[model samples]
Target: MSIVIIQGPHAHGLASGELQRNLQPLALAAGRTLEWFRCHELRDFVACVRSAKRRASEFMLLDPGELGLQAMAHPEAGLGDALDEVDTPYVEVHEDASTELGIQPGQHHAPVATVIINGDIGCSYRIGLGIALRQLDDEGIAVRAA
Candidate 1:
């Protein structure tokens, strides 16, 4: 399955990069191949998701800060309202997640430990990624420079 990971700006330090790297472990453990697209801009995120949808049967958009949540939290913030434009489902990885997700402070670069995944997906690979993501979130880990 093709997964487009939307690393929102809220993802501080190297969280985005760390998230990208950690996907490998999830793929390895699941014995599945995952096509990941990392994006920061809203336009790029939308394009990547759209592109993935066209090519893959399953698609996922992961934003740790709850891209939609943040948007909805603010009525005047067009960002929250823009969530409606995304047709696909998404999973919001919270700032304070579980330790099993391998989150830690002052960590730059993806965590080598087991990945913590969370979110919605139909494929097994996506499931693994979700678990890994969760681990990362819980640990409060990041990929920024030490």
Candidate 2:
């Protein structure tokens, strides 16, 4: 079991660059490496989740950019439904409350998320990842890390 992150579309490359820098140490210490996917379309998100389910990931980290917006704009889109296909726990992450692009925490993705984090991009991911790792540990999945 390992970690997977599926993020929504974003124009800012800095967020990812910074996120990688912040996550590297955490991942290394955990004795884990993350598989990351940047989704360009909502279907891509579903497909990625299904893929994670197939792999039986320890947990999933989701950045619901357009997915959150889609959920709010059209509840019929079944974003939540798609997520339900995977039993893997998910940590929902959002950009800092101060400079969010389109989505914010507790807007729509709240109901299904195992944990919700809102803060600086890298920090939010850091916190979310930490929480996920701890959860895995608590569940006795492994102390090696989620």
Candidate 3:
């Protein structure tokens, strides 16, 4: 199955320029090209996800920590509400997947296997992503964050 890795400036805490620099190496390592999209609205993002699913057999989302941070910044905005509303499968990143599972970081590791719905931000941003990733991993859904 083909895999799709989606990450953008908005996904990370950095501005577009910084994100571009960070992603450049990742793009090279992936040994494939990525389709970069600037998210102006939620609907457009959803459409892009659908398109990706259609193009690839397996879709892997690489969500930078910023999107979750923004949601946390504006809790009233209901950052996750839109993604939840779309009814898709997705996952977020984790700094210490082992801690959440109560295991060593390198041993007896449980790979994330479910769709993550994120609403994390700032210092706890990674934590929020970890929670959603674990849940989705448990459910065995691919990740797609907007």
Candidate 4:
């Protein structure tokens, strides 16, 4: 199965390589083909997510960073709506807790399955991957070993 990770603008200077490294073992164990997208702009992030929808990714992990939060607070930005269009089950990973942000995943009709690993990027992706794998397994979908 294929999995896509979409990161937001603030991720640019962050330790994404470390996050990817942490995700590798879980991805391998689940036999998932993984792809990563670090979006520097909201439009780019929307486009990437739309593309993932077209490709039918088994699951997606999104760390929307600052851009996403900003978009969420501003309706005109439309990022939430764009994300809502994705059919794949997705977990929203946050670098801060929802309580800190006062926003929750799936708020305003977005289909976020869960929110995970607040304040910890690497652990978020790792745990998110495990959840995705388990969800697939529960559905009787075979995860190919990498």
* Model number with the top lDDT: 4
Worst 10 residues of 3 by lDDT: 96-105
Model 1 residue 114 CA deviation in Å: 20
For candidate 1, the 10 contiguous residues with the lowest summed lDDT are 99-108
Please rank every candidate by TM-score, starting with the best. Answer: 4, 2, 1, 3
User: Per-residue lDDT for 34-139 in model 3, tens only?
Assistant: 3455444434444454566456423334343334344345534533443334333444433322212121224322223322324322223333333443453444
| Best of the two (3, 4) by TM-score | 4
Let me know the TM-score candidate 1 reaches against the reference structure.
0.44
TM per model?
A: 0.44, 0.75, 0.38, 0.78
What lDDT does candidate 1 reach at residue 52? 47
Ranked by lDDT, top first? 4, 2, 1, 3
RMSD (Å) of each candidate, 1 decimal:
13.9, 4.9, 11.2, 4.3
Q: What's the distance in Å from true for residue 52, model 2?
A: 1.0
| Worst 10 contiguous positions by lDDT, candidate 2 | 96-105
Among all candidates shown, the one with the greatest TM-score = 4
Candidate 2 lDDT by residue in tens digits, 44-102: 77778778877778888887664656655664666665666676777777763322223
Of the pair 1 and 4, which is ahead by TM-score? 4
Model 2 residue 130 lDDT score: 88
